[model samples]
Target chain A: MATETAAATGGQASPIALEEAGICVDSHGGAIGLPQLCPDWMGNQIFWLAVTLVIIFFVLSRIALPRIAAVLAERQGTITNDIAAAEDLKVKASEAEAAYDKALADARSDAQAIVAQTKADIKADLDAAMAKADAEIAAKTAEGEKAIAEIRAGALDAVKEVAKDTAREIVAAMGGQADAKTVNAAVTSQMKG
Target chain B: MATDVNGAAEQSGGLVFHPMDQFIIKPLFGDGGVGIFTVTNITLWMAITVLATIALLVLGSSSRSTIPTRMQSIAELAYGFIRKMVEDVAGRDALPYFPYIMTIFMFVVMANFVGLLPGAFTSTSHIGVTAVLALLVFFSVTIIGFVKHGAGFLSLFWISAAPLPLRPILALIEVISYFVRPVSHSIRLAGNMMAGHAVMKVFAAFAPMIIISTGIGLVVTPLSILAIAAIYALEVLVAFIQAYVFTILTCVYLKDALHPAH
Candidate 1:
């Protein structure tokens, strides 16, 4: 505040002094042409300008820029990696589905083959049992025929013997002997006839 | 009415309000003559711009989170904005100078925005700063053009596609425009900033006058305030646009440097 007052007073006291000194105090009590017309300020402004701009350039190029670039690159890399991983999973899922399909097909064919083989085995067993049963039935019928023929022959012989005994009794009642041989001869002749 | 008071003060040799007083460069410490070593308001504001840039670009984004915070997003937005400007206007080959272009963009934009603060100095509003920046662009582009294309860089001035009779005349015009680039570039930014700030100051001067006046104060005060508000909004847009224009022009000049064909 003191310096401001002093500068203001100095401007009032000797405006010519300030103007001759190249201090930019105009008639309006304001500075003009310091940034454009003044030579001394140029050198200082240029010097500081160079210094500040160089520092800013270095800061941006070396530190801030590279960091941002790295972040962008990292994000891109992650996105690509995720896409590749998803593609790999998709391929694996399709492969699993194919394997399941193949296994199901194989199981169906395997079951069909087993059923066919079992059916063949059962048919062979049934045919063999039927042949054995037919042979046993034929043998029993032959044996029954032989037994009936033997009984009929025995009945014929007993009937011939009775007939001969009856003839002999009749002959004894009638007071005539020697009839057994005759009776036997007569029965045998009748049976032959 | 403030102009009348200022005029009366000037005639009376009393206190005169100089709106341009804000643009003065005085030594921060003493009333001594400013030398090359004297730290002036320009230096202070420039240093502030640098610090603010560091805070935004370095410290704000130090984490580099994939999900950015607001400050980090701002840094990234600025980075991408300048990068695209360099690439789109200057082409892919100009990407090597992206950092330089980005520095200038950030510095100008931050200086302009910070200057909008009530009592802050606007360093970029001075020709000393803008001229240096523009000359740097001009010199670097010229050097790159000479180094890359040798004598062929002169072809930028020669319009080969023009009619044979008017070619020399066209070339003269082109050369004059080419040399005028730095002058116009520096003046454009400084002029816009200086003009906008001066206008706001003028409006502010009116505000006090009209508010204190007996009869017209009621009506004129609100009008001045509204004008200030409206121009303030416009200045905000102008600040961003001027920075953008400076950067894009730099890129365009760089493109010429890299490819000097007509």
Candidate 2:
């Protein structure tokens, strides 16, 4: 084939140059016939094909494929871990909210208790003060009543004495006999009536 | 056909370009027959495919980060995509073959995209390459089926649900289809890749041809360029789809192998 191509090239200057340059210028019905008819080229192609394919297979099975698989797996792991972390954080946040709500309820109850106790204490103090004031007023009233009764008794006695004197004088002026005891008795009876 | 075109183009005194010339295999070093040891363009491109795979998968995922870099994300995307595909289509038992399926997907997709570059060879375009791949899947599935089900694996072709009289005919058809899997599998990939690349080349060849005639050149050149662009876009989609189809089909076959009852 080389000699034939060489001889043909000698006759044709352009084809020879193209042939020498490794450009397939002979044009044996394009690529269709070469692989089927040329035993030499076919055998070489198959040989290199096996070599390259084997290399590729091993590289993929051992090195390339495993690496890609690992990367994918690692990415998946990261995603799952992130999701789990988010879930845990969510649980913790709920717990904190629950604690906050409980604390608020406790503080409210404590405040209510304190208010109720303070109110009771203030009421007790007010009642004690009221009782003391009532007792002092009652004592003053009793003293005022005693003083008035004494004054009344003294005045009544004075009035009786004056009546007795007047009655004695009248009896002397009218030239009629009148004793002091009788006059006193009569005045007392009138006052009593 | 190529020589005839070349002769006619020569007689016309126009530039004779061979669009199919890119598919030829020759030695990379010296002028000689391509032996099993000769390094050819197929070897070179296939090596590039391997290196590209390594770069994207091995080195790209070396970081193994929780927050991925761009390359790492791409690597991880491919990993998850193929892993899920295998698991979904082939079941969880097919997970053991995940690496192999992933390797095929990455290699074919990378080879196809790389081939789209200017002046680059598409190794997967060759039946020689695709056949080996398909054959590997074929043999693996068969072996796994036998190992798993023993004589029961043959029941994969037997349609018990069919009418009693149609069972034998249906089984025969199923057996033929089963044997034809590797052929169709390999040809589908190779044919699609070859056809897309060849169409692009044909459109490109026309772009230069427009220069031969000024009046037609004005219209044809722009049209050819536009056509090339359109086809190139479609080829990009084809590249991904072919790879996907190949991998998914492989998973389906693996499923059949693992559970051949249906």
Candidate 3:
């Protein structure tokens, strides 16, 4: 308070400057009191404040605010679109995976079917070859039996002839001739017994 | 004078404390009266604040890229912060007024932070500036309330939840408090800014204590400096908090105007 009143005896340089400075600054360019309370500067301060607020509001509303809002909205839209695309890609990828799995399963079943067909074909061929081989062996065994029978018959006939000839030779040597009929009958009876 | 030499230690050299002088509205150029048209420090600082707002809001978002740059992201963050505030506090219906709220937030924040620069004048510290900001909010909210609800806006002062007999008293209190909103709002910001700056100035005045007396100065100067640093950090926090408080309060007031039920 003393400092404020001391300004009454302040510098006598210019009373106008003193009044314009308001009761805020002292003669020595120091603050006499709170400058905020001075009424002289309030008008210009408010005026400038108004100008500033107006400028800021104008720039923000007209340019900055809209620009920022658009950028944000655009960014949001891009994110949403990107997310949607990712979801679509994910669906497609899953579909492809499903298709791949189905293909693999089909190939496996087809391979199994092929293996079964080949096994059946091989079994049929083996059964047919074994049957043909058994038929050939049976035919060869029948022929061998017939040949052996024929040979035995021929040997029996030869034995009968030998008996008849031996009887004739014995009869000639002993002065007694035997008949062929009698020799044949004796040989037949002996073979039967 | 007794003012300069209050203490005996002041007798050595004149100790003048011009803490309030930083707030004096001086013309940027020559000595002149601060007429409404006169270009003062207020204009300069306010212009700087305006430029900063433009730089952050306009130029920063020029890319409009989905992958935002730092400046763009900062701009977006500020926008989203205030937009969400207006949406949450004032309701979605108040989105049309978002730009206005955004302007207030950016200006106050920029003015505060910019004013923290050394030797800089704090515009928001002055009642002249804060009063206008507060009054703008006050008038706009009131007008919007009346426009939206007509006489129904008065319901805000009438607490429907209160007992019928006590309703009148509560309404009276509400009306008075509602009227005091501008005063409190403006004073809250200005007082915070003024108090912080003044306290810092007082601390700074002690920074030269060593020049006064090496004996007392040795301890006092370092302490004062440390106090200044500590207060500076606090002031930085106060600066942002005050701006947030001002904007959020604006949003709250706007909500009352929009709803006005209780």
Candidate 4:
């Protein structure tokens, strides 16, 4: 009802004023009268579209790219640092290996010297024992020879006593008168022989 | 009866409701709230927008040389302008969204310009059109936020930098803000287009009056012509500005969606 009144008012007033002013205005094909498929829809589309576009702009520009770049840069830095560290470690390892080899060589030489010294000591001890055994055998042989010479001398002395005794007994049986001269001569001859 | 009708009409507010008219074009609907459906009118405009953007972009990009042509320079200027805007608003993280931003700016700028054509339909004039576009953005951004942060996206509305005691109040504000997105998004474009057209109509309605007088008619008619010319130029500037404003807002929204800081 209100719309009808407003429309009637507009219709009456606009035409009357135009006629009074000796002018006829045709508003049929005016910009406002164009048949739109959906004004509300069009308006909404435009509004929401603008919003969406802005959102997309904000997200891509501010958040995602910077983080990605930062992560990439950090990764690159870490990788480079790791490579450098590995190189340094390699050099250090090589130096350590060299030092280890030198120490091993020195230890090996030291061990060889100790072994040679021990072998020499053992050889000397063996030679000394052999020399001592030879000395003992020589001393025993000399003592045995000395004992044999003494025994021969005693046997000879006994033999001589027995011969004299036998000669005396034979003389005494033969003649009393020639006993003393015979005994003396026999004794003298025995001394000269 | 006519007098009574007028009296009653005057008592009530002057509200015109046309039930026979299709308020918002429903290009797509289904029996159940399911499946893909197409919106014909919007789809047509969308295609038009895309083609117009491609035309401009292709033409602009075709002239590639050490010494750039005017068209190329203009394109470059637009690119640089949006790029700077994104950088300033979203920071350095906005590079990947560059394509989308550029596309939005180009599409909107073209749509606005097309409205200025002699007999072209102003697509942004309707609320339904604006609503769809707004809803698209709203849903897209919300989905993006969820995809990126999963369940944590809800925290954006619930949490803020405010103190514990003030958190509830802040949460309420956040919720209001979230709901208001579609309204603001739709209103901005509709408001600009409506205001511009209304003013133009007011000025144009005066054209016949100025031409009716004999001696004054000559002076007034040209003056009206000049006014129209001036208004038209202003409208052009407005068109470009509206497009830029729309695209910028979209960028801002997208930034929040991606980040979603309390």
Candidate 5:
């Protein structure tokens, strides 16, 4: 192949011949094409150095760098917009969170109020029932006391009538000798005492 | 030996030396493509490109605020952009692989951009550099595929998209496609870089000649400048495109690895 020949020829060139030809050669048998390439390691170093420098410098200076800078600038603008948006959202979220907590507290108090109202209503009902029972008990006690006083008065009147009848019978049985006048006097005296 | 003095003279002043020629750079050729190839320039450029990218990213990302400053915002945006790219292409499951994708994007973009700098080396122009990157992707995808899919990963080659009669032929083609990934990946980058630089060099060689020839040659100077500018713009576009392409391909390859279908 052409490449193989070039490689072979390029490898076999002697130092003196290469120098005469104004080419610097490396020990690896490759001739440095440009006179700018020194015969020492310096030559090889310089050649590649120039090639690298040229390519990097060219690409960066002209194309890649500008595009990158443009992209960066655009991205920066977007980020600023995004940060501003996020801060706004965060503030809104905090307000919403506070409102939510307040609403929850209100809801809890409303529930407690309902519970307290229910309890008070139940207690009122219970107290009314107890008061009614007490009134009934007092009425029953007063009625029973009136009935007892009437019964006691009736018993005393019955005892007084029975005593008069018995005494009259006893006086008659004892007399023929026992006169009505005497009996009446004795009974009247006893009654008087 | 046949020596043509006229041809030599014609090419003599026209030749633009490599940027690394300034330093005592050494070349190491592996599976040689351009006869005797050295990677000294490649290594150096890669180092500088990486360092520059890191410095920019680090400096940019170091300061973060609720209302980001210009540099901080730019850095965050780049980070988020690459993050979104990975998420979109590779899916949420590939979130863990963000670091790799980000790194690849930064390195490729940096390499491409660095080539635009005056007298700076374009690391991606060399086949060896691109090849290594491509090879790394190839190996990584292969390993991940095998690990995730086990022996079933082999079934990926047998996709039945082709007609039943041509299934075997199609499968063979598929296999070859998989093998050709590294070549295509590397060649795309290397070829683009080489062509762009070569054109620029050819134009640059005329600048001095134009100057030496007095005002007569000066007419070409504007043309040269214009050509350089045009090429520079193209290189910038190429840089972004190459980085995107490389990242996208990585996503696709990773997808195949994580989810194999027969």
Candidate 6:
């Protein structure tokens, strides 16, 4: 590489002179042609390349590759394990959700039962209180009617007594007083008619 | 030796581009001819890549946390990406070869990204390197197919599903294609890396056009710089895509080897 620059700065070597040297490059460092085709360099590159390949082969096969393979396999295993764990966690979460739903449903049913019981109890108490109040109202209405009937009978009987006494007093005052029985009979007949 | 001879000469008082010069392998310690085992820029960059791979793969995952940190995530992403590709393209039976396929992917991808750094040498761009990588997959897959299935592996090239009349022709094509896999696989990666780098260098050469001619430079300089930036961004994408293509192609071939059914 430096030879090319040197040739650019310095003078060109005579073709024959550089050719007689039996080398690829002229003394001025410029290549006679494409250096890749140069037989002089092929041997060196091929030889070193063989050594380099062998060294690389050994380094990779014996050490690097196996190490890398282990790391990769380990990573793969770890990923698989993590996914499995996630799946397990997911299953557990669903189970917990199911349990929660079951408990909620159970509580809802229990609340409905309690509400029904309370409603039924209140209805039974109201029905009994209504029945008791209706019975009391009927009893009071029958007693009040019986007491009015008694008062009327007593007043009618008293009116008959007073009519007989007034008849006897009027007869005596007129100087032709009828008997009490007769007056009572006559007033009863008149009241009857 | 490169025969293009595209040398830089300021005496011409014009643009002298040496785009291929960056691919040249030079000794790290001193100026000398590169021997087979010479420690050149290739070695330096390859070492750097290997270190980066290790650091990312080994130390990054040292924690082995169930929860990955950033570096650990990157390492794991790479591992899982290739592992899935191999499994999907090949069969479950191909898992035994996971480490081998993983090594190639890590090497190619790391070298590509590392090369993208300014002044870095791209190891995957060289045919020598890519060819070797491809051939290893080719040869190993071939051997595995033969060892596992014996003569039955030849059926990979023999298409019984085709009508008997055209079977031979189709078989011939299949045989040719099967043989050409390594060539195509290797060249695809190298060519992509090389071509992108060369285009970037070509554009970069014009970046100093203003110094040469203010009149033409005003138009050329900014355009060239923009082109380089755009190509650089594309190269970054290509670097990863090429690596993916190579590794997946390897898996596809491995599938043929393992199954060889059709």
- Candidate 3 per-residue C-alpha lDDT over B205-250 given as tens digits, one digit per residue, 9 for 90 to 100: 8888798689999999999999999999999999999999999999
Q: Mind sharing the TM-score for model 4?
A: 0.49
Model 6, A1-193: lDDT tens per residue? 3344334433444544444444467544666556776766777888898898899989999999888888878888989999999999999999999999999999999999999999999999999999999999999999999999999999999998898788888887899858878888988998899
**Candidate 6 CAPRI category:** acceptable
Native interface contact recovery, model 1: 0.51
Docking category of candidate 4: incorrect
RMSD of candidates 1 onward, in order: 7.4, 5.3, 4.4, 22.1, 17.5, 3.8
| Candidate 4 lDDT by residue in tens digits, A1-193 | 1122334443445534433432222122111122233232344355435544454445434543343334445656878999999999999999999999999999999999999999999999999999999999899888888888888888877766665666777776775444655665676678669
Which residue pairs in candidate 3 have backbone atoms (N, alpha carbon, C) closer than 3 angstroms, thus clashing? none
lDDT at residue B33 of model 3 (Cα atoms): 61
Which candidate tops DockQ? 6
For model 4, how big is the iRMS in angstroms? Answer: 12.1
DockQ-derived CAPRI band for the predicted complex in model 2:
acceptable
lDDT by residue (B1-262, candidate 2, tens digit) is: 4445666777886765555567777677876767787888888898899999999998888877789999999988889999999999999999999989998999899999999998899988888889999999999999999999999999899887888899899999999999999999999998898888888888887786566988888998899899999999999999999999999999999999999987
Interface RMSD of 6: 4.6
Worst 10-residue lDDT window, candidate 6 chain B: B1-10
TM-score of chain A of each: 0.53, 0.58, 0.68, 0.54, 0.54, 0.76
Off by over 4 Å in 5: A1-193, B1-43, B212-218
List runs of model 1 lying over 4 Å from the truth.
A1-23, A27-29, A32-40, A93-193, B1-17
Weakest 10 consecutive residues, lDDT, candidate 5 chain B? B17-26
Give residue B148's lDDT in candidate 5 (0 to 100). Answer: 78
Interface RMSD of 3: 5.1
Model 5, span B163-252: residue lDDT tens: 788878878998999999999997898678767776777676666656456575678877878888898888889877887787788888
The estimated TM-scores of all candidates read 0.72, 0.80, 0.85, 0.49, 0.55, 0.89
Using lDDT as the measure, what is the rank order of every candidate, best first?
A: 6, 3, 2, 1, 5, 4
**Considering every candidate listed, which one attains the maximal TM-score?**
6
Off by over 4 Å in 2: A2-40, A132-193, B1-17, B208-218
> In lDDT terms, which candidate is top?
6
